[model samples]
Target: MELKRTNVPFLLSLALVVLLALLPVTKTWAVGIALLLGAAVSNTVPSAAPSGLGKMRKLALNTAVVLFGFGLNIGQVISVGGQGFWQTAVSLGVIISLGYFLLRFFRLDGDTMKLITFGTSICGGSAIAAVSSVMKARDEEIGVAMGVVFLLNTVALFAFPLLAGAVSLSPEQYGIWCALSIHDTSSVVGAAAFLGDTSLSTATIMKLTRTLWITPIVFVLSLRQGEKGKLSVPLFIVLFLLASAAASVLPFPVLFKSLASAGKVFMAAALYMVGFGLHRSVVKKAGAGGMLFGGILWSVSIVVGYVLASLS
Candidate 1:
């Protein structure tokens, strides 16, 4: 008889990630919840799933990005009036630099640390996925990095909203804050929801500005990795632009709205796959060291976010 590993633990982590994403936290210490949840789930599988599933995961995250467009308005995204743009850019650069150095100081492996840091400081789980594929990073490295981002993403979602209220920031300012601060579109949207529909609308624009950087970042990382080949960017990115354009020009609200909703569904499926495939042992073996490095990376991002928001 042959024995097979079912990957139950990994599945558990994937489910937890999705749940945290789905929830809207405000003034409830959502960060703590996200931390616990991220810790609880992930690292369950003995190995990566089949290639087909990997493709599915990639599709889901891309769809999530697209659906994200529906959550915002085209005109407002254009009229952000250039406040905090430099602040966001500067803060992002600083955070990446600081986190990268810190990880090396702690003697972590460079590639894994870079992937994790880039993932947390830039977009979130999605960025990590794109970079991992482009650079051919180990699955374990990707998993560990994503787990940390998942934790901080939740924290940003809940805590940022409360802070937004406390400071009484305007929609433009708050949108910039959310755009620059949170790691994922989900976190950005989740945090903005606490402020109201309009914040979600404006922040989406601010984030799109940041999301555009992923391609160039991937290209540079690929070059350094010597992972460069033909180096054509993903087709989905092209589709994402088209979707955004359609959202911008389409006169009918319903069309744009449906496109956005489709994006969310794909993301949800991706979340499910991540949860279902995780393993308990992998998470255990990840050790305190890896997660700690991820935390430091996340912290640097948060500080950068604050500076950027203030300047904006």
Candidate 2:
């Protein structure tokens, strides 16, 4: 029997993972694969929980977040410390605020704008995931936000390195730029390594600063929900923070490396899920103008990131 379109995405995830595993993209990009699988499983898995694979999706996302620390050493994150922390806070405010303004200008209504603003301003996919859980955003809003970030992420992946090379930026400067501007950790690494190891280290430090804001950002959003009415510190947010701490304390050479590697696989899967979740019928209802408006938000935000980086 032919599989449904939903099942097709899962198959594609499996095929891509198998094929790409032979290429050089495996270690970190594996997270993208895990994202794909997660998205696919969420849509396609049957209700027969015993026979289904949906549980893996959650495991993959959690593992991906924890293992992500391996890509960034705790020592490096701490070394940058105060300055890195401040820069992250400032940049985050700038990006998210810019997103809210531009989205409002687009005249986009309701929750879609909020999620998009949060996603662009915070840490890309992770921001969307976290905010969605806390705000109880509808799936349509999540899809729109993901679609916007994915497009911009592809652009940042290519653009940041070329810009850095053209300007002849130092490893430190380029690293800080990548860490602050790029959408996610994987993209940051690609942009950083485009420069060198020193750039990678510095970029990861910058990115770590951004990750730390995830907690505060979520807390702020939870409050905006007027938590006094019914909101509180989300369990998932706490879970995310706890996962980070555990990763920092875990000891061992080989096992840690493997867990870290598993984490990458999960991230890959999550990203793939983002792409596969696209539901054209629903987004199309928002109209072409809606898409254009989202694009404008991203375009303006990129300019904001570059201008701020130049100033720094």
* Clash totals, every prediction: 21, 21
The local lDDT score (0 to 100) that residue 231 gets in candidate 2 is 34
Which regions in candidate 1 have their CA more than 4 angstroms from the true location? 1-61, 64-73, 81-85, 133-136, 226-250, 254-286
Residue-level error in angstroms, candidate 2, position 190: 5.0
What TM-score fits each model?
0.68, 0.65
Error of 1 at 161 (Å): 3.3
| Highest-lDDT candidate | 1
Native-referenced Cα lDDT, model 2: 0.60
RMSDs, each prediction? 6.0, 5.9
Tens digits of per-residue lDDT, candidate 1, 145-181, equal 7766665665676688778867756766677778887
